[model samples]
Target: MSDTPELPWPVPDERFRHWAGQFADMHHLVRDLVIPLGLPQAAESVLTTARELIRMSYFRYEFMMIGAGTSIIAIEAALADRYGKGNLAGYLKKAHADGHLTKEQYDLLDSFGRPIRNKYAHGDLTHVALTPPLAIGMLRTAITLLAELHATPSPGPSAGGN
Candidate 1:
């Protein structure tokens, strides 16, 4: 007998199970059909990685947007005393220019992250494709931005007692 312990079968909902079965069947059929195409192993590996990166990019974009939105809300709340009527991008730029974000961090977000996120949000996926490195960089910048926004001190009365 095998040394590995038997795991209990997961009981999924009927609809989910049905869909999963269909997906698996289709995947196997596609694989079988494509095997005869004689694609190089390296090319297949790259294709697989590209597919995963595309899926991961979409996931990261959604969370990055959420994180950025939450960070904006925090910044707005903290600076409510001095808040002005403006767009989110304006506030973000003001925050960066005012020394809230490091120069490198701001540059990364402004130059790459924001435009990609906007494209995805506006359903313009055809115009922008995200690579794994780019997605990772954007996520890192977003995390840093959120942390900085969260750690910011709330605005208060002038120090000179104005």
Candidate 2:
């Protein structure tokens, strides 16, 4: 007999299969998504790690919050990679001002994205809540934004000679 112990809670095969389906759906989402290779390695690692947490969250609800928190951190890391040494709003403002992001993109990020990320980053854990859909949405948004950030060419040295 296998030495493994059963979980205290019931984990029926059917339920496990169902969770597998959810995991597959999440895997497929990330599989089809691609981020630029030019991005800082840390940003890519963070995104991947966040996705793994999201996958695990399907197995356990607690992981969902951790995954959600990591998702926003991944976004922040991507922003830091692109903009460097600044807060979310400042980085986004620079992105918009430089025409790297469209007005709508900026507005979308500024509206809910900033607040959600801040809620986690600033440690508002008691009030923070997350569902799989919302966590997946956050992951998707982070990847999309990271791609956009990397795809945009950084401004070169100023035209005028030093």
lDDT score at residue 108, model 2, on the 0-100 scale: 56
Show the colliding residue pairs in model 1: none
Model 1 spans > 4 angstroms off: 1-84, 156-162
Tens digits of lDDT, candidate 2, 1-162:
879997686232232353356555656644644545766687788777777876665566556556656766776666676666889889778878976557766675676567767776777743655555666666676777777777776554454758
Model 2 residue 14 lDDT score: 34
* Full-model lDDT for every candidate: 0.44, 0.65
* TM-score for each model: 0.44, 0.64
Which residue segments of model 2 deviate by more than 4 Å?
1-31, 34-38, 97-108, 156-162
TM-score of 2: 0.64
Model 1 per-residue lDDT tens digits across residues 104-123: 76676667656654665566
Supply candidate 1's per-residue lDDT for 162: 57
Relative to the unseen true structure, what is the Cα RMSD of model 1? 16.5
Best-performing candidate as measured by lDDT: 2
In terms of lDDT, model 2 sits at 0.65
